[model samples]
Target: MSKVLTVDPSLCTGCHRCEMWCSLTKYGEINPSRSNIYVLRREPAVDVPVICVQCGLCINACPTGALKRDGATDAVVVDADVCSGCGTCVKICPYGVLRLDEDTGVAAKCDLCGGSPACASHCPQGAIKYEDINKAAARRRELWAMACAVRIRG
Candidate 1:
């Protein structure tokens, strides 16, 4: 019953609060570059929050075997001691969530804040949520059904 981070792009306001909290909590600084969650902004006031889905792609991509899933949280854990600062994991991440922290000299991404995600907890706009995978999928399906109903009625 591991929970996963979910994002609602439509509700995001590009506030970057999630990034700030993440950076502060993990690195004790306000550097967004070190934050695992990134906000991708587009024209016309669109903001999309990108986060790690813990898909294990980075774990497989790591040549030094630095990345692995935490058995307790199911979040990607980066072993800095074992990591060689290679960018393979960064490049192979399908969501582009992984990045090499210049200060730490190791690949960094969301570790779910050791189970409770700060990004989801501190989001001002309710754009992010942490829930069980099954519940999240069911919610998405419900939203889709509501959208389709609206379209049909209109």
Candidate 2:
């Protein structure tokens, strides 16, 4: 089964270890701006890790056909050679996870690190998990059901 990155905001502690590892693995540095996974912190002390869900929506939006899903990993990847850095993918992404690399002048986002994501593997809080897509969907449904039950009871 293909895998996906599942995020649990409740587990996140804003440690930024995911970002550090991601950038280090990808760029040989600890630059958060270059990391594909981003941690957004809310005013109420909430940290939400945002990343490419590999939904493939951006692939359809790429005019240059730079974005394509890797057959092995099901990861939406950017082909630097084909990418025009037009920023269309960035705008098309509903979650706003895509970006153009400042140095490369090319589109960049999570490629699941060739199927074993650095962000998910290094996340200290277990906020990000690399798991089967079906499992992730089932988990999401369970969470939704629990939330609905609480709402109905209250």
Candidate 3:
């Protein structure tokens, strides 16, 4: 069962705690730009946390075979040595989660912190969850079913 990071945008408070924790854990700093999990602020109070969902589109887009999935964590691992910093992976990423590190010139994305994601653990609003994709999909379907029932009754 592959687990993925899921975000509930409605519950996000835009505190950037996820970003801070991600940067601190990965880079030992508090730079949001370096954080793999980013907050997209569309309005003053509306924020969406953008993260890599392990969709594999970036892996296919990598021309140098630098991106591959880690079987243990199901997270995409970027091989800096093999990567040419071509930016194709970054450009093809649908969620814009991949970024080329300015200093390293290597593409960076969420690696799920080697299976225990810091962002999901530190999310203040319970907006982010790391769960099995099948279980998550089932829960989503249940929610939609309840919503439809309410609409029909009302």
Order the candidate numbers by lDDT, best to worst: 2, 1, 3
Model 3: pairs clashing at backbone N, Cα or C within 3 Å: none
- Report the lDDT tens digits of candidate 1 across residue range 46-150: 998988888998888799999988999999899999999989998898988888899989988899999889999999898999998998898778768887898
lDDT (10s digit) by residue, model 3, range 12-41: 999999999999998899999899999999
Off by over 4 Å in 1: 142-154
Total clashes in model 2, counting residue pairs 3 or more apart in sequence or in different chains: 0
lDDT of 3: 0.90
CA lDDT, every model vs. true structure: 0.91, 0.92, 0.90
lDDT at 152 for candidate 1? 100
Count clashing residue pairs per candidate.
0, 0, 0
> Over the stretch 1-154, how does candidate 2's per-residue lDDT look in tens digits?
8889998887999999999999999999999999999999997998999988888999989999999989999889899999999999999999999999999999999999998899999888788999988999997787688878989999
Per-residue error for 10 in candidate 1, Å, reads 1.2
**TM-score for each predicted model, relative to the true structure:** 0.90, 0.92, 0.87
- Model 1 lDDT on a 0 to 1 scale: 0.91
Worst 10 residues of 3 by lDDT: 138-147
Which prediction has more favorable lDDT, 1 or 3? 1
